[model samples]
Target: MTTILLVDSHDDARRTLATALGKLRSDWTIAQADSGLAAMSQMDDKSATGHVDVIITESQLVDMEGVTLLDQVRSSAQQPLRFTLSSNSEAEAVLANSRANQRFLLKPVSAEQLANIIERSMRLQHALNEERLNLYMSTVNAVPSVPAIYDEMMKELASAHSSLIKVASITESDTGLTVTVLKIVNSAFYGLSNRVESVGQAVTLLGVHLIKNITLTTKVFARFKGSKLSARRLTQLNDEAMRIGALANQFARLAKLSRSTTDHCQIAGMMANVGELIATSKAESDDGQPSLSIEIIGARLLDSWLMPYAVVEAVALQHESPPRNVDMLSPLVVLHSIRYLQKTFTDTTDDQQRTLCHEYLAQLVPPAVAEDWMDAFHAIEQLTAAKPPRAA
Candidate 1:
């Protein structure tokens, strides 16, 4: 049975949340603790009704900060999904210290919001093969921590006085990140008349939203630098990511999708292969495959980082054929179609797979629509090919 532990110093608040959650999910056994230490004790109890599957805590505990509780829980063997409740004032500090498998919910969290979080978290956990993921994680020498600069960028962006200049300053703090941001902005994908030589310039040209996504993609790739994977292989992966990202962005724009969705599509496409990178980094040999599929691993990682649900879902489902009833132009559809088309056009020789891709698209959209998408993709490929490769 699913179990949840609610940690809060206030007796009334703790009981209120538990009662609401209990009503929402009658099957879930709700436990309560008034302090961080007590929460840990409840979790440690061998005789507890069942192992805790999730933990929700207030930002401030009588005994310790909620972040401290999060750190302890994450280090524990069970590592239940960690969430901390904080007001806007405390969000920055809370975010600064938290890592994967943890999330921060702003205070005044409604019962509905909490329920949604639980549902999504449970669904993600169930989708992943926990045993295999654990085994794979154990074998890796080091899993990248959530990038500190990324966290800082987020905090800065959330500030009332947030500015592109301040964001640029934060990016510059990490020299490697600065170089990467500049490199991507200046790439042919953006098609700027002049080169972008600084983070400030990139931010001014692309706007903060696009730059933020680019920063995240670059930082994630940077973490895997100097891994067991060869430089050539890594470079190839980076190039492919950029290509997919550019294609996804172009598709979104051509379809006139919302700016938010366009950003999601771009990032999801860029990050679709992150699982492959992670698996390759820890491979025992050059071609060794992890027991878990790249999609699951990448999804798990992205979910932990608190990525948009759509982006995470797109990555998880990138390798799967689209559901018959799914929207033809949704972010997931765009990403899946782009990835499949790119693969088929390049090196995917499986006739069965190619047939399935074509059939899926044909089922969802008219023949002409599918053809237009294909034409657009090929146009993007040709444009990309025409540009000289830029230095990393």
Candidate 2:
């Protein structure tokens, strides 16, 4: 049975929430704690397996604040999914305590909403290789933190009337981020008529969602700076990401997928090599390198940063072998096809290898469409190669 700890200062509220959660799922075992110390004791108890699957607590507890309690849980070896049921007004505290693996639920949450988030989180947890995720995160010197700009962008996105100007304004706070955004906006991928002079102009042209993703992507690259990977190696990986991202976006369009889907495919492509980047960074000595699955590490990093689920799924499964049951032009399919084609196109001049690549694409799409996708990809590659290097 999945055990959940419901911690609250008020005994009645704790019991009431436990009852409601229990009613939602009979298989669940709910435990109530009235203080942070009690919650900690419950976590360390032997009969409870020394951990619970989820911890739901109020912002105000008898002993300590919820954020502090959650922080302790986060830093512990036991990585239970965390949620905070607090007043909607404490958005800042919620954001402070929350990580990629945790969520903040406003107070007065209904049973249905609670059940829905719990079930979704459980499914995500099961889908992920949890043990491996914990091991990798524990060892990494620096897993990127969620940037403040990302939170601001999320707020703008969630607002009833979000303005492009406002979103752009948030980027102004970070000169490095603003420069990166403009560089990508004016990159060969977009093929804009004129160079973008400011973040506002880029946001208006690229759309807020895409700009938001770009901000997050750029922030991660900036944050993970002190790695052991050589500058040449890092640049090579980044160039490949750009190539894959441009090709994936073009492929998505050729498949007639939605704009949002295309953007996701692009972001996934840019992030596809993140696991390798992290692994290379975490290497103990330059004499030898650690061997780790890039996809799993990338997936765990994204999940920890609270990126969109679709983006995480695409990155995590990018290197998966064929025999997947997914939409023909889905982000995952597009990314896989693009990556396969990219490697095939680069590493092989043999006719047999080319034919094999075609077969792979045909497995994902019609032969005619596959050919057209390759043609578009080739065009983008040539165009990007001709462009001068983007300022770092």
Candidate 3:
């Protein structure tokens, strides 16, 4: 029988999730604990027979923070599945510290949601064992990736020296390169233009500096020429990044962040997974096949780029603690997790994406504000949905 543990400081939350889960997954030997102290006492009791198969804990434990409790559990090196069930925003550090997930369950979870978590857990365990689940996390971890060149172009535009016109000519030097760059910038994904022509014109309009940066970005896209990855997944990675950048830009704007700051944040969010791009592209060209995936090549690629310590730390220890002085609202985390959410649109419960989403809603978003350009995020979502794949 599958075993599970439910730990929470609140009597209501602990009992509620336990009851819902018990009814939905009767096969589970569900165990309940009132606080971190009680949970540990239960785990310490060998009579319970090797602890619960999974431990779902709340962020505010009676004795310690959820992350502290998770740290203790991780120290034991047990294989039982672990999850963080919380309504508090601080759980992100807990989730990030736990590496895979310490599985998550938002408060007032319904029976359907409980069953879904159990099911998803089973799938993750299965995929974990097989090591070829076609997942984004794994693939991104395996290769070297560089920032999307276009993101750099934007950054340049944000710089004091930026001129869109100069930027355009540099990338347009090659006819094929020009088409690819325009396909992205003016594509439904960017929501840029109905009629953008020659690189020179694009530069003149957006500014020569902006055009130069676009050219830099075009160079990066051109690298995707021969990777063996699925057309669908590759396109998904790119679209998600663009959407994240768009969302971040909107948030920064709404937050009243300076235009330059907003632009940098936009680029940072878009290129957070850049190391993966560089690695996969190189692997594709060298082997005459796509040797790495966006999922697997992620970590190694980041390492290769010698990226900022913050990003490297974030990617390296996403499942465990790495330094992130940056706030959840800070551009990086928003984009990082949004990309994950976009990838796993299917399931929740005790899942990493769910934890990130909860943390984002609770911690990242500022006070209720409606003039939300966040719709741009969804817009890119729809654009990628209907648009043709960037041909392999």
Candidate 4:
């Protein structure tokens, strides 16, 4: 049976969540601890009995913060999925400490919301194991806790006094980052009719939130130049990432998803292939393919960089379909659709390809979005085609 551990300082909140979860997932066993130390003890007690499936905790514990407790749990051989509860004020701190695939829930979460998110987290854990992804993730070097410029940008955005112009100025100060961001905006993935020559222009077209994400992913790619992969191959991977990201953004915009959601869709799209940098470096020499998946590797690295949970989940599940649910507008779905489009268009069959493309769009998106989907796709195609290719 599935097992879950709930950790919270408040007795009432802990019991409430445990009771609700028990009702929602009657077959699963539910356990609770009043503090981080006790939670670790509970994990130790359950280690031999298949460990815990999920750990749900409040941000503040008597002895330590939720993320610190989960970090300790993660360092152990057992890898239970982690979720932390936080008020809006503690969001930045939680994001900093949250593991690559761990999730965060806001305060006052409803019973139905908690139940559903936990169920999804459990389902995600199964998907990770079944795919044998994350099996070799430990072998990969951890990405930096967070890149400098990206961290600064996040802080600026969080401040009420910060403005887009200020963030753009910060991005402009980094020449390499500025060039990379402009390249992406000018590339086919962004699909703009007019060329964007500067960081300010690009930020004008795409929001600052997205530009910051782009900067982070680009910096990671730049760091990989010293890796085992050849310069040419790294370039190809970067190109692929850009294409996927652009397509995912188009899909989100066409579907009228929220601006925040759209930004995550692009971030997930851009970073989905990150694990390949490690996988190819270490595992390519082996005869058979490694059981580990690049998606998990990428997700973990992104998490280490303190990317939001939405971006991490989208990247992790990009290659796997979550169980069908009422929420069709999820970033994961957007990433999946983009991947499908890339695969279907792999061959250049003129007529047959067109028909297949139309069919895929119609079936993948809701009826309400079908018309806008075509418009969005064509606009992106034209925008990308107009730009001259750049060396990867």
Q: Specify the highest-lDDT model's number.
A: 1
Across 179-245, the per-residue lDDT of candidate 4 in tens digits comes to 8788777766654799998888777887786788788778778877876678888888887677667
Q: Candidate 4 has which clashing residue pairs, if any?
A: 188-384
Give the candidates in order of lDDT, highest first: 1, 2, 4, 3
User: In model 4, where do residues sit more than 4 Å from their true spots?
Assistant: 1-21, 28-116, 125-135, 141-145, 188-197, 284-289, 326-328, 345-364, 378-392
Worst 10-residue stretch by lDDT in candidate 2? 92-101
Tell me the TM-score of each prediction against the true structure.
0.65, 0.65, 0.44, 0.70
Q: Give the lDDT of residue 357 in candidate 3.
A: 48
Instruction: Name model 3 segments beyond 4 Å from true.
Output: 1-164, 200-218, 227-236, 239-241, 272-328, 340-360, 369-374, 388-392
Could you give candidate 3's per-residue lDDT for residues 72-95 as a string of tens digits? 775564655566656655454224
lDDT of 4: 0.71
Q: What is the lDDT of residue 97 in candidate 2?
A: 20
C-alpha lDDT values of all predictions: 0.74, 0.72, 0.52, 0.71
Which candidate has the highest TM-score of all? 4
Which is better, 2 or 3, measured by TM-score? 2
Q: What is candidate 1's lDDT per residue for 1-392, written digit by digit as tens?
A: 88989999999988988999899889889999999899999988947746888898887889987877877887888868777766655453334333532555656777767776677657766786487787776666646766787778777765557778998888888887788778877777777999888888888888776777777778777777777778887778888787888788877777766565677788788888888888888774545678678888888777767665567778888877666644435567788888778767552345665455666567756665665666677666776778744325
